[model samples]
Target: MKTQQRVGAGPGRGLAAALGATVCAAVFTAAALPGTAWAAGESPYGFDGGAQPIKGAATSLDARPLTAGQSYRDSIKKDGKLYYRVDLGTQENAYVSVVAVPKAGGAAEYGDGITVTLQDGSGAQCGYQDSSFASATFTRPITAYAHRTIEPDRSTCQQAGAYYVLVERTSKAASPPDDWQLEIRYVPEPGVTQNGPTELPENWPSSSPPPPVGGPQKRQGGTGFHDATSLRQGEWRADIEPGQTLFYRVPVDWGQQVFATAELGSSPTGATGYVPNALVLSLDNPARGHVDQNTVSYDGKPATLALDPHRPVAFENRYSSHSTTNALRFAGWYHLSATLSPEIVKEYGDRPVQLTLRVNVTGTPKAGPAYAGDAGPFQVTADDRDAAASGASGDEAGTNDGMVVVAAAGIGAGTVLLAGLGVWSFAGRRRAARDAARGGPGGPQDGPSPFGPPPPAW
Candidate 1:
């Protein structure tokens, strides 16, 4: 019945087709909208050539405390850097990540690269990582994780006191950027108690990790946090810009396990120009804690991630018995964030990269244990799961029909676009094959015998 709501929330194909036709008719009857007028030879999306020097913008270092399962959203200017404070216990681990989104319209291109540094109160650098934008089009989130202390000794940053995180732009622009949205995610590792030899679970390395079981692939629709698309069981297809990031949420009841794989589609000519080691697929728990993460190069390979309750421990933190043993403590909405770096966009321009997503959400929702305390902010309702997946607003009941219609139209349009892309890709491959066979002056296969065996060294 619950899964039905996810699928039935949107209109059927027949209704969507009919509605699309009606919408197209309405569009034809209306006058065409005028195109945007801009100054000649100036970048339309860039600043209006009125960018000010970065030095002029004043910034104050304000360190805000970060907590587990919390994301702080703010903005930073081109010349400015944002700082946050984080405190760690000797027994706990800390993980931090920053995601930057360009502000709409009148934005100046602040080339790739944003630097994040972790330092102590005395200004000593601890651990830092710099994340470059995939392209001006999109940026993949950058992350860093560290424990309270290292055995032999690495950096002074691994201590029980206060640590600061600094985020700044690495590229300079003619005009100062208005601001870019930054989402900071912090995860506090669960503490572990040294219990005797650690009663190793049967799922531990005593047995090899199971290989991912191939399943149906599904399409993703939401390309950002605000519009993450809903997903159900089945094969789906979609296209993404080279540097685009997509968010999708799935409902996992108590005792459920989720497995997903993301694969890059071959280019039009069956060869992607350059692959960047920037495709990252991350899974977050209901509380927004970093449960697990994986990064893979888009070199025509699939990246797979599975949250099997049999082994909730992330490969990186498996040594920590406490965190891994209790990783799956919640049963609610799990968020999946998938991103491709801008290098693809830079090399391919507006050409879309097709992606096939395979998702397996198994298990039924079992009744949770009764709570003795008062109902806090989270009472856990049946609708909570679906609401998060749908990005539904407060007045969902009133706009159910409208939302269904809109979603139907969107899904229909997405399918048609994919079809067009497939045809274009096939045509490109055919043309390339024909050109190679011809081997004419302009063909890529021209003059292939130039350096064969150094002319037999005669």
Candidate 2:
């Protein structure tokens, strides 16, 4: 009779079970790493990782509610109009911005764009803004904003009640039919204890100043408003690829005037073909409201795009009839975005084009209005000033580089740990099976096992 033997109760089996648990733990550790490690290569128009997914209603009746100081991600079909609701207090001003990102390499007409409007429940329009692809030969992300301001003399949209943000896409028959991704942000400004002059400044500098003088500092631009690289008055250098956009922010305090110029270097491949609106540079206020924009054509040659001379940041600028001046109503991080058209990919090869940014912030900083409550994200704090001066990204501030290094190291270690554990687990199982077949711990060895040498004693 064969000797009685108990199956699945030996030390080898125990070791195999423990190894499986170790493998799982290794995987968990890797998964817990900070997500920003992978963000470096993400698309410039990608939505924020922390943005909440939301669906916009076709009509105001079913409109979703948007909270202040939060971002929501959604999509809009061609020619589709979507509505969202926001409840506001009479003491605060609400600014809403919508960013529409078209499909990469998609067909788009010059007039294709998006419109945003803020209206009262009774259909009274408070503010409206629209952005277009303009002369761009290819699709890219465009932004527009609307606001509901509580002014002393303003009549409409002043009540402390619900307001609707209407977003409408304008597309031609030749435009791509795919739905465009949308990033919606709502920023609320508290009422000021003391109001500034309501009249626009009569005598402000209107001439563009000379560009900043210095050697260009290497700085990697961020993807969007949330991650815009911080820069002070200086010339910064980076690279741009076709269909890519880079965002940077400059802290413009009250009484300070900011100017920027974007220069695109000649094509690397020397490929020659004229493409209209090949490069576009835009400026937006702290609320992400469009301030001004300039575009230039490209033909394998260097090109420069400069923004119009902007007035200093002042509370009275809000009363100006000019959109550029009106947008300079607050002191905060002003965003600068540079976009290279996809048409360059066809005319010029896919090589990254060298780009240089000349940024100038002049004038002494002045005191801001006293707010009844916290000034929220629109106010530039001491930390923000420091970050800008040090040339750091907005999200990570001063520690972005360190965090990236730590994340890379952690990832490397995790990969090695997981790989080692996987090998050990495989070897241990093979050895356990071989020993079990031979009858127990003191079983006979049948030459060298095929899997590998037995796992080292743990």
TM-score of 1: 0.45
**Alpha carbon deviation, residue 380, candidate 1 (Å):** 7.1
lDDT of 1 by residue, 1-458 (tens): 00000000056888667755655433322111111112442111111111111221122246767765444556677667767777875554455656555532222343554665566777776544444433333344432232232222344655578877777766555544456656566655443333222233445332222333433233444534323444533333556665556666655554346666666665565445555454666665543344555555654444333333334222122233343233344454566777666666555565777666655555444443233322221123445534432333222211222222333445466544443344334434543553343231121121221111211100
Model 2 C-alpha lDDT versus the unseen true structure: 0.72
TM agreement with the true structure for every prediction: 0.45, 0.78
Instruction: Estimate, for each residue in 1-458, the C-alpha lDDT of model 2 and write its tens digit.
Output: 00111000099778667655655555444333322332554334745544667899988879999988777889899899999999998888888899887765555786888888988889988888788877665777778888887677777888888899999998888877888889899989888887767776578777777766656766767767766877877777888888888889988877788889999888777677998888889888888888888888988888898887878888777666676777788878899999888877787778788899998787766777777887666566677766665555564552222223234445455444554555445444544553344232221222331112212111
The lDDT of each candidate is 0.44, 0.72
The local lDDT score (0 to 100) that residue 63 gets in candidate 1 is: 70
* All-Cα superposition RMSD per candidate: 18.3, 19.6
